[model samples]
Target: MKGLLFCVGLIMNCLFSTVSFAQTQNVSQQDALANTQKQLQINRYKYSTKAPKAIDGNSDFNSMDITSHGGDLAKLLGDNIYKVDSLVVRGTVDDVDFHTLWDASFNGKLSVINMENAEVKNGIIPEDAFWHSEQLNIEDGYITLIHLRRIILPNGIKRIEDAAFSYVVNLEDVNIPSELQYIGPSAFEQCENLKTDPLVFPEGFEKLDEAVFANCTNLTGKVVLPSTIKEIGEAAFWRAKISSINFPEGLEKIGDGAFYGCRLEEVHIPNSCKDLGIFAFKLNKELKEMHLPDGIERIPNNFADCCINLSHVNIPSSVKSIGKEAFQSCWCLNDVELPLGLESIDKDAFQSCYAFGQLVFPATLNFLGEECCTYLTGVKRIYSMASEPPACEVSTLNIGDTPFGGYDSPSTPNDIPVYVPVGAAEKYRKAWGWDYFTNFIETDDFPTAIHNININKPNAQNKVYDLNGSKVANPQKGQIYIINGKKRIFIN
Candidate 1:
C-alpha cells in the first residue's frame, strides 16, 4: 500500500511539471510575436506623409514604394534588387544616396521617378547629384543643381543659382518653367549639345546674370530678351554659337564681353540700350552687319575688336565718342556711315582695316588719337566735311601715325587724296599736317576723278607706281604698289 501511494505522487508531480513547461513556451512565443508587431506598427506611424511600406530584403519588385529617411534607402535596396523596375519614395528627403539610386534604378532604366519637395535647408541642389539621369522632373521647390540631360522644372522655382546645369554635355531639352525670374552665373555653361527654341524671357523676369550661357558651343536659334529686363551681365553668351538674338525695345545695359566670341551674324540695338561695356561684340567673326541704337553715347574700348568679317555698320546720330581699339584688325569692314554728333576717335580705332575705301569726317569732330587710321592699305580717298580741320593730337605736319609699311619720315604716301570744301583748300594746305597731303581737290572735283583712279595689274607690260604715285619700271625697295590688282604694302 505504501509503494502504490509513492508512485502515484511521483506521476502527478511529473504531469504538473510537463504542463508548466508547455504553458511557459506558448506565452514566450506570444510575447515575441507581439513585440515584432509593435515594432512594425511604430515604424509605420513614424512618417507624417507616407507612400507605402517598403520591404527590407526583397529583390524583385512590382512597383514597391517606401518612405526613406536620412539616406537609408541606399542600404535597404540591396545590390540584388536589379530586377526592381520602379521606385517612388515620398517623404521629406533631406539626405539621399545618388549612387545607390542610380544603380537600383537599373542604371537609370526605372522609367518614372518623382522626387518632389526634396527639402534642403539652404535651397541649393548639391553639385552633380543628378548626373546620370537621362530624364527627370523637379517640382514644388528651387534646389539649385546641375547635370540632367532632359528636365522639366517646377513652376514655383524663382531662380537658378550659379553653376547650375553646367557641363552637362548630353543635355538636349530643358523645359524652363514660366515663373522662373533669375538665372545666375554659368547656369547652362558648357552644355555642348543643348538646343532650344527661341528663348523668350517671361514678362516679369528681370536679369540674365554673368556667364549664363558661356561656352555653349552647340546652342542654336534665337534668344528674345524680355522688355522688363534691365541688365545682361558679363560674358552672357561668350563662345556661344548662337546665330541671332533679339534685344527688346526697353533693354537698358549690356555688360562687358557680353557677346564675345560668338557667331552672331547681325544685331540691331534698340534705342533704349544706353550703356555698352568693353569688348561687347569682340571676335564675332561672322558678324557681317550691325546698326548702333540712337541713344548710345559712346562705343567702349575694344568694343568690336577682331571682327574680321564685318562689312557694314551704321552709327546713329546720338553717338559722341568712339573708344580705343574699337575696330582694330577688322580686315573685311568695307563701309560705315559716321554720324554728325561724333567728337572723338580713340587710338587704333580703325587699324589694319585693308578694305575700307572711303571715310567722311563730320564738322563737329574735335579730337583724333595716335595711330587712329594706321595700316589701312586700301583707303584711297578721305572726304573732310569739316570746314575747319579737327585738332590733331600732335603738332607735326603728319595726320596720325605714319601709314603701316611707311617710314617714320614726315612725308605721307601722297597717293591718298584728301578732298575738302571748295574754299577750304588753302586753309588745309597751311594747316600743320594738311600740307603733307600731295593730292587735294575741291569736293565738287573730287568724287568722279577719284573713283576713276586706276589700280593696274603688274605684268611685263605694266608699270608700277611708287608710294608717291610716280611711275617706275622696276619694283623699288621701301615702296608699296598695286601688283596684279592687289595692294601690296611692302618695305624691302
Candidate 2:
C-alpha cells in the first residue's frame, strides 16, 4: 500500500507540472497580443486650420523616480498633437546619456505625431548647439515613405531645422501645425511617394526653400501656390509630372524655365509681367493661343516655334518688335494683321507663309526688307489704305521691254494688263514702257475698250522669264522659273 501511494504522488506531481507549463504559454501569447494591439491601433487625425495655440510650462519631466520610469508615455498621450513642453534634463551633461520623449516604440508608428512643444531636452542637449538637420536623420532606398502616416505636430514646434527628415522614404505623409512657419531646402527631397495622392499645401506658409520636393515624380495631382510666397528659383519643379497650377496674384518674375514643359494647356499673363525671356515656351505645342499683356514690349525669336497648331495671332498694339524667324515654318498661319505700332520687320520675319494670301497695310508703312514675303508668292492682292497705290516693279514691264524681265522687244506684247491711276494712262505710256497697243482704256471708260486688266489677278497672263530675267518655261505645276534666278517663285 505504501509503494502504491508513493507512485500515485509522483504521477500527480507530473500532471501539475504539465498544467503549469500550458498556463504559462497561454499567458505569454496574451501579453504579446496586447502589446501588438497598442502598437498598431492608429488614430489617424490630420491638422486643421485653427488659430495657433501656445503651450504652458509646468511639467517637471526629469524627477528621479520618473527619469528611470522609461519613455514619457503619459506625456506623449496627453495631447492630440506633440509639441516640445520644457527641457527634460536626464543625467549630467558629460555623462553622454540620451533621453527619449515618446517610448522608442511607445505610441508606435500608428499615431499621428503632433510635434508642437516637443524638442531636445537641456542638460543633455540644448537646441542651438545641436545642428538638428544633421541629427534626427534617416537613410532608406525604398520609395513608399509610409512611416509618417499618423504623425501629429502641435503648435509650439515652431521650426523644422534643415536636414530634419532626410531620406525617410517610409514617411508616407507629413503633419504641419499652424504655429510652424519655416522649412529648409531638401527637407523632403526624395520622399517620392509620401502620400497616396499628391500633397496638399496648408495655408499661411509664405516661403518654400529650394528643392523642397525635387524629383518627386510619383507625387501626382494639382497644387495651388500660396499667396504668401514672393519668389521661386530655377528647376524648382524640374522633371515633375504635375497636372495643373494656378499662380497667385503677387507674383513678379518667373525664374528661368520655372514651369517649363508642364502639361498646362493655357495660362493668363497678368499685367505684372514686364519681360518674357527667350524660348520661354519653345516646345509647348499644346498651347494654341496666347494673348500677351500690354505691358510686354519685345518677343524673342522662335519663342513660339514648333507650335504646329498655332494658326491665327494678333499682336497687341504695345509690342514694338518681333524677333527674326519668330513665325518661321508656321504652316498653319493664315491671316496676319500687323500692329500699326510696329516699326520694323526683321529679315525672314514672315517667310514660308504661303497661306497668307493678303497683307493689308496702312500708308504709314515705308520699308520692305529682304525676304519679308519671299515665299508668299500666292498673294494676289496688295491693298493699301494709303492715299496712293503702293509701287510695284512691274510698271517697267508694260512701258518697255527693259523691265519685262529683261525682254527688250520680242517677248513683250499686249498679253499683260496694267491698272493705272484714272487719267494717268497716257502719262504711264510715256514714263512707263507698257504703251504698246492703241487700246488705252480709261478707268472711267472701261466699257469702251471692253478688255481691261486688273493687275491684282491678271488672268491675261504675263511673259515668263528665267533666273537670268530671260524667258525659259511656261507656268506649270506651281513653279515659275526665270533665267538668272529671277526670284523662282511658287505660284498657286
Please give the RMSD of candidate 1 to the true structure.
25.9
Counted clashes in each candidate structure = 2, 47
lDDT, candidate 1, 1-492, per-residue tens: 111112222433421122221122234323522432221111121111112223454534455465666467666656433544556554434325444554444242333334443333233433333332222212322212222345444445556666555555556766555666888666776566778767667778888876677767777777877678888877688777888988888888887678878888998878888878776788899888887888787887777888999877767778888877789888898745577888988667787887877677777776776666767777777777677876655523343443222234532244577888888888877765455566777785322111123434456766576533456676655335654333353343
In candidate 2, what are the lDDT values of residues 1-492, reduced to their tens digit? 111112222433421122221122234323422332222111121212112223354322221112222244444434422232232322222112211332211222222333333432221121211112222212321112222333444444445544344334445566554545565544554444555343444466555554344445554556566665455433244333455555565555443233434344455555565545333343345555555556566555444544445555656666666654456555556556566555555434565655655455443343433334445534443333323332323322134222222233422233333444465556545543233322433353211111222222113354555322345445554433432223334353
**TM-score of every candidate:** 0.62, 0.40
Whole-model lDDT per candidate? 0.60, 0.40
Residue 437 lDDT (model 1)? 63
In model 2, where do residues sit more than 4 Å from their true spots?
1-215, 275-282, 288-291, 300-314, 322-338, 342-492
Candidate 1 least-lDDT 10 residues: 40-49
